[model samples]
Target chain A: MVGIVVVSHSERAAEGISEIAAEMAGDTRIEPVGGDGQGGIGTVPDAIEAAIDAAAGGDEGGDAGDLDPVVVLVDLGSAVMNADVAVELSDAEATIADAPVLEGAVNAAVAATDPSATVESVREQAEAARDVDKL
Target chain B: MTEDGAAAVAAVAAVAERIEAERDHLTELDSAIGDADHGGNMARGWAAAAEAARDLDDPDTGTVAKTVGKTLMSEVGGASGPLFGGSLVFAAAELDGGVDAETAVAFAETYLEKVEDRGDARVGDQTMVDALTPAVHTFKKSIETDDLPPIEALAKAVDAAERGVAFTVPIRARKGRASYLGWRSVGHQDPGATSTLFILEELLAVAADRLGVDAPETDATSPTIPDEDPDEGASEDD
Candidate 1:
């Protein structure tokens, strides 16, 4: 199954987004990571990379052979930059979804439950949320 | 240690000292249009980067630059972590055979490219691209077209960046956290651009000091930085 990672500036926000998305995750793995390493608000590349590893079913800095494809959803600003750096640093087949983090995570979680779901398909589905209208 | 590496490390150490001294000023600039962490975050990250580079065993120019970038990536919080640090790490590869006039130009261009790629910002976005584009261009022009000496080229680049930083004032931001301020972002100096000028100033100072010569005089006239990204890669996020 495809994996989902949520990254935000706040630790609790990432975890909460992950929790909300997990409602539709089924067998899909979802991981959340954030914060400045300290207890403050910021994003770190190392933490995002660790979450990618975990989401892909691999250990930190371990062999990526056992991992699955991972899709990352991120908040604005540094979260996007940190996620990009983490994706560059990780060995997993991971890409960041250019969509709203919460909405994209939820949409990606549901899409990942399908047996035919791929990293690309899941990402496309997540990005589809960009046009979602709620009035 | 290689001379190139030693001088590069010394330049980074000088940047750390300058950032430390300007912490309040940087933070004050950020407070107007961004999260007020730019000052403290940059100071802390550069200090750590300087120490880490100094602690390296048999470091070279590329190694010192990579170490500094990696340290900034992990230590500098917010968008700057990747903007300044991650970009440097990628650009450090250009210095593998050690620093020279040609390689320094390559390093600056690569660094600017990476920052643009990561930030999705353009020269007129009122971001660091403002300062970096002109400095990198002037440095390359001085070295390649005008056939100037390295120190003189560097001095010109620093002056170019100073003007670029000045150009940031009165322009509305189209990228970074400051963009959130809309029209209010105008009239405030960009901290990232300001920091870029400060770093360039330190690099020129260190290069002159190490070369046993006085820093050459350079001119800063009207804004010479471009009005657009050369590749036109800026996205319409604003």
Candidate 2:
């Protein structure tokens, strides 16, 4: 199954994004990771890497599939950079979508549930949110 | 010269010491245009990196660098974490076979490439790329073209990085946190550039000490093209 990971600078933001994304995520795994691992507001590569690892696995307690493809959605600045590092350092196949966090997560979550979903397809869906118009 | 695990650890230790000592200065530079956490973040990261490198068991130079980079990527809580530490981690592979004149150039080039790619900043952006580009270019040319000893090449690279740091002082910020300042960022020295220069200087000093050679005097404006020596550690730049 295609997986989606959401990364933000705030732990709360990441969880909140995940919560919203889960509404459309179906049975697909959605992992949320953020924060500096302390009481501060920032992102860490280790945290992001772990999130990718988690998202790359099968549901709740199922056997972890090795090298499961994963698509990651990230917020601005260091969040994106950290995700890039995590993708490079992670063993699982992962790619970070260059799109807005919340909208991209929701889009990615939905796209990942499709039977034909691939990491690239899900990433494309997530990046498609970049041109989302609120008007 | 192939740096053993122990030598790489020593270099990391020296860099950590220098960064710790200059923490306040770096923060001051950042305060004028950035979030003022560069000092604390870098000091904390490098300290942890030194410790991590020391903990490795009979590791190679590449292992030491990768360890230090991973430590920094986690500890330095800002764009610098990826820009500095993450880039190092990505570039550590260049040193896996060992460090020599050719491998060193490749490592420098790869490190510079990663930093630029991560930050999306070029030479005139008044970011760390300003310092790194000149340093790597100088190191490559000095070693491959001028046939200088690695120690002397490092000295020249440090000089180039020093100049790059100075160049950042008068330029308007075009990238990173400082870019938010607009024209106000002009006049303040870039903290990242300054820190990059400091790291290169420490590397040069450690390399000189390791090679048991005098710290060569070098000027960015004038590189000494010494007489040809055949035994230099030159390898094909494939």
Candidate 3:
């Protein structure tokens, strides 16, 4: 199973989106990292890095299957930047999806939770959210 | 050269003070073109950076630079945070020791490379690259001249960054939230560019102060404003 990480500039937004998205996550790990550590409006790269680690099961050091491939969905401008930095800082294999935050997280969660999901497939599913018609 | 990281620490502290002083002005600039959070974000970020630097235990230049990068990454939200943080991270990697002419040049080159790579922004993108690109070039060129001292090279870089900020006022933004504004983004100084200029000015000021070199004031002479045709790049060629 692929893992999913959600990054938002607001703590509530990241956590709430992750919670909503987790409904479709099944066994997939979905980690939410957001805001400055001080409960302010800003993305923190360190928090994102920790999320990536947890999502990838790096903290557990379990079987190879536990270290699932990770895909990150980011909200807005700085979230993308901070996520990129987080990915660079972390040792896990991760990719950032360029898609709408909420929609992408939901779609990615669904895709990633599938038993056959790969990192690329999960990312593609998330990116495909851009075409979702909300009208 | 013997000082491990004190010079870099002081430079970052100066940057924090400068950002605090100009926070309102930067936010005002962003209000015209962005979400109006640039000033607050930068002020918080730099203050965190200064605080982070203060906690370092007998740090090296690399350590100070890396701490600043990490602090900004964790404190500043939005595009500027990552862009600036990533730049500093790479710049720290480029530092051999204390910040001198060579270290500054290396830091500039690496920082610009990381920022451009992260943001996919070009010289005329009306982002921080607009300011950093020219500043790095001027710093490198001045250092290479040999006639100019380290402080003079730094001054030239600061001047170039300020000019870059002015250049942002005339061009429509092509990146970030301001890009959504299209032509409306023109005539407003980009908050990111202004902040970049402030950072460069502070770095130069710190270096001059520590080295006992008389630094040139940033506002001593204004840079030449380019012609006012807004769509020069867009209409350059068919």
Each candidate's TM vs. the true structure?
Answer: 0.93, 0.91, 0.86
Q: How would you encode candidate 1's per-residue C-alpha lDDT over B85-121 as one tens digit per residue? A: 9999999999998778889999999999999999999
The native-contact fraction of candidate 1 is: 0.97
CA lDDT scores, all candidates in order: 0.91, 0.88, 0.84
Error of 1 at A101 (Å): 1.4
- The segments of candidate 3 whose C-alpha lies over 4 angstroms from its true place after superposition are A62-66, A133-135, B1-4, B96-100, B145-147, B216-238
Winner on TM-score (1 vs 2)? 1
In candidate 2, which residue ranges exceed 4 Å CA deviation? A58-66, B1-3, B224-238
Q: Regarding lDDT, does 2 or 3 come out ahead?
A: 2
Tens-place lDDT per residue, model 3, A21-133, is 98988878889888777767777788898999899988777764557679999987777878888888887889999999899999999898677889999999999999999
RMSD of 2: 6.4
On lDDT, the leading prediction is: 1
Q: Superposing all C-alpha atoms, what RMSD in Å does each candidate have to the true structure?
A: 6.7, 6.4, 5.6
List of clashing residue pairs for candidate 3: A78-B78, A78-B79
Return the top candidate by DockQ: 1
Question: Per-candidate interface C-alpha RMSD?
Answer: 0.6, 0.6, 1.3
